[model samples]
Target: MLKIFQDLRELPKEEQKRSNIRNIIAGFILIITLLIIMGFTTLGGVNTFFETLRHYSETGELLISLDRARLYEQTFEKENSLNSADKAQQSIDQSIKLANTWNTNKNPP
Candidate 1:
């Protein structure tokens, strides 16, 4: 590499200018290639992050549904109201639907 630089320094002005242009073009190509690779990597990371957020949101909804179902059940047990029983059943059905959705999203075919 040292000898190559020494030879470059001894070249004619016109040859030196051509060599410099070629080096600049090569450097630019390298930088563009790296940028393209990084762009793809960053895009994949962003997609994965959003997917994780969606999964967490679905899980939270499922948990909330289950908690509501439990509360409704306790209310029915205490008051023995048919309305409370119906609401509890609805909450349980919502929880099941949410759970199925979460499972499907987590394991896509």
Candidate 2:
């Protein structure tokens, strides 16, 4: 330990500074490389990550709600008939499935 301290003290101040800078740069490069590798290995998981963020954003939520409203509108727009009733039932089932997904996502195991 004493020899190590002596060697450290013998290192020039400028040399120590340069060494620290190199180490910092190396650490940053390592982090960036790992991130790139992870993104590539995950098959565009990074894109999905950003997309999820966008989907949760205010504008994205508004657009999604609008889409849901449009779906309901279409279901209601159909003429009253057995076929229309079947379509409405399908829509209801889909809505339930979506709701279940939401619940599961919010309360993950």
Candidate 3:
């Protein structure tokens, strides 16, 4: 092993430069992986979940902004509106009500 390292030390300038870059890149990748592992372990899964949720909320807000802009462009007017998820929730609530009604009638209690 010592002889092999000694042979590597005597390599040409370009090869030595490549070796240094290879070592640097490998070390950088390893350090990044270790940091990520430490972060996830220290934050815990629940904390990660909440952090992910926070990111999702930000994305949702961006989507809502785009929708609002599109709506404005189509109408050439501004109007207040609920977010898309709120509209979806309203639809879901209506569907649940209809389902419950059907279930109640079918039972005929």
Candidate 4:
């Protein structure tokens, strides 16, 4: 590298200017390449984070629905009312819907 610079210093003024321009272009290319790689890596990490958050949210909602269904079932057992049975069925349906949504989101085509 030192020998290369020594030869460059010996070149004519116009040749030196061209060499400098080439060096600048090379530097810019290197910087741009690095930036693009970093940008993609950062974007991938962000996408993963959001997907995880969505999964957690769906899981939480599913759990809540299940809990509600359990409570309704217990109520129906105690009182033997048609209304409680219907509510439990509705909660089970909601839980099924959430699970489907979560599955679809987790495995997109």
Candidate 5:
């Protein structure tokens, strides 16, 4: 270790300058490499976030449209069944009465 220190102290002036330049260059390269990797990592996370938002928006729009379509379909069905309206209403009334009777008779509190 003493010999190594002595040799470093005896090194040529031009060689010392070159060594300093090399160290500076290596340090700059390492910093730039880290910045590039961080940039890419941030870009990837941003892309994934936007992708998830896009899919969520599309899914919400699809569900809303489906709900509207179902509502229109049910409306159309009721309108087209006008000829059998009275019979349908009577059947619904009878079913409600039956359900009420069962509820009142079974496990009543």
Candidate 6:
């Protein structure tokens, strides 16, 4: 290997240029191969900022729906106690806030 490397270094300029071009092509091939492998293995699945934002909004909507359902169930319960009504109101309020937050463009602090 050492002898081969020395021989390469002693080659003519034209040969060295060919070697350089070959090495560049090999490097590009290696990078593309690694990217393909990563894609197949899902290792290159980094989320973009927009994707993260979309997921966050989706989660918020789901939570709001669940809260609204709980509030509705509480309102229809047999007891119909004042405490339950208050709790239900709180849940509805939280759900509304969550929905508004999702609709707004401002980032959360």
Which of the numbered candidates is closest to the native, going by highest lDDT? 1
Which 10-residue window of candidate 2 scores lowest in summed lDDT?
57-66
Residue 49 error for model 3, in Å? 15
Against the true structure, candidate 6 reaches a TM-score of: 0.43
Q: Which stretches of candidate 6 lie over 4 Å from their true place?
A: 1-77, 106-109
Q: Could you estimate the TM-score for every candidate?
A: 0.81, 0.37, 0.32, 0.67, 0.47, 0.43
Winner of 2 and 6 under TM-score: 6
Sort by lDDT, best first.
Answer: 1, 4, 6, 2, 5, 3
RMSD of 1: 6.8
Candidate 4 per-residue lDDT, tens place, 1-109, comes to 9999987877777787999999999999999999999999999999999988988988999899989999999999999999999999999899899888888888897
User: What's model 6's lDDT at 86?
Assistant: 73
Tens digits of per-residue lDDT, candidate 3, 1-109, equal 9999887777777687999999999999999999999988987977879867866665555556556545544443333344544554555555556556545644668
Q: Candidate 5, residues 18-55: lDDT per residue as tens digits?
A: 99999999999999999999999999999999967866
Error of 5 at 109 (Å): 56
In terms of TM-score, which candidate is stronger, 2 or 3? 2
Candidate 4 local accuracy as lDDT? 0.92
The weakest ten consecutive residues by lDDT in model 1 span 7-16
Candidates ranked, most accurate by TM-score first: 1, 4, 5, 6, 2, 3
Give the winner by TM-score. 1
Q: What is the lDDT of residue 61 in candidate 3?
A: 54
In angstroms, the error of model 4 at 56 is 1.0
For candidate 2, report its TM-score.
0.37
Candidate 5's C-alpha runs over 4 A off are: 1-20, 77-109
**Alpha carbon lDDT of each predicted model:** 0.94, 0.70, 0.66, 0.92, 0.69, 0.74
Per-residue lDDT of 12 in model 3: 78
Scored by lDDT, model 2 comes in at 0.70
